[model samples]
Target: MSTTYHAAAVVGCRIPKSKIFLTEKVRECEHNIPESRIKDDEFCAKCGKPLWVTLHKTIPEYNRDMNTLCTFRVFDIEWEDFITVAGPGAVSEVANDCEKPSQLIHLPASDVRKRMERGLEKIGLWDDNEFGIWAILWGS
Candidate 1:
């Protein structure tokens, strides 16, 4: 089976996981900024804290459908280290790094939702929708 690899930078504050707050209602914050304003360097509406933002894009020719098999790994590296290598070329750098592990975690599409729910529950943030769950996970 052919598989695609993907990576995403989860931008958020460096706060404790349990204390992090995420909300999709950006207008509810005191600033009343629209949701579209929630980009890198924007502050959290609920906490009024600054956010770290980075640009990411997928090559149109490499897009994959929801049914595609995929594998990924999350690396918790320093921001300076990440920024130094951040770009389209970074993927090739990672692929060529002999020191890095060759194995990647693979989850079947059928089990994704269930596994995600279990993970969120374990972190006391179950039932959160896409944006909220991702913010909480990355903010912590």
Candidate 2:
């Protein structure tokens, strides 16, 4: 079997995973308006060290013939090429903390499809006539 990478879309809303927030910060330095990329500060909302944010794409779906059907796809904010940002500290000290890391989140197709369906339902986009689930990768 050949392993392939899929780009996930930011649907409905987006949230960071916290582990990679700092990495995104560094990448923002290269951009003019860095605020667009930074979801929030690098510090973890719970712990204060540093946190990463994860963006999730939500799709709407419905049921038909004992099968789930997707209606429409909602695209959220798009993430730039960079990933994390630095936490509190000097530029030199935080510079090294910046690193765009590729994270592999194994989301089963079944679960993914289910979530998409639910997301679509929540947004009133569920369509029983439609079918098939689309794969979305982050930072794609």
Candidate 3:
């Protein structure tokens, strides 16, 4: 028997996704944000570092789709270019062809965890026990 190998470059994020509902009041600072972009908090999952926030929203697979919330991590790789050798269940690109988020606001793990954890729990993705899980895993 012989072993096969696969290699690729991908940006991974279990990245919290939230929909800004029209019915919800927009923050004064966020009012200028366009519908084509998502303004989110981006922090280092480990070491409590804030990286950035918000990103360009990709062309939606469905037009008029209102709600936008995701529960799992997405591997953003160019699938169209790597599908032949890539493994199954892995992505070639972000869910909606989304781009890198802006790096304006910075927050640490301490500040981001509780908020992300709560949101995940509400969506049934993470359990109460998984709070602060990010602080311990991964390294700089």
Highest-TM-score candidate: 3
Candidate 1 vs candidate 3, TM-score winner = 3
lDDT of 3: 0.32
Cα lDDT of model 1 by residue, 87-118, tens digit: 11112212222345323224333354454445
TM values, all candidates: 0.24, 0.23, 0.24
Q: Predictions ranked by lDDT, top down?
A: 2, 3, 1
Cα lDDT of candidate 2 equals: 0.33
List candidate 2 stretches off by more than 4 Å: 1-101, 127-140
Native-to-model Cα distance after best TM-score fit, residue 115 in candidate 3, in Å: 0.3
lDDT of 2 at 100: 36
Q: How does model 2 score by TM-score?
A: 0.23
Candidate 3 global Cα RMSD:
20.7
lDDT of each: 0.31, 0.33, 0.32
Off by over 4 Å in 1: 1-74, 80-94, 97-105, 131-140
Error of 2 at 71 (Å): 17
Per-residue CA lDDT of model 2 for 31-83, tens digit only, reads 33355434666553344544444443322222323222233223222553222
Q: Could you arrange the candidates by TM-score from highest to lowest? A: 3, 1, 2
Per-residue CA lDDT of candidate 3, range 47-115, in tens?
A: 344444345453232122432234323322232221111111222231122354333224454444555
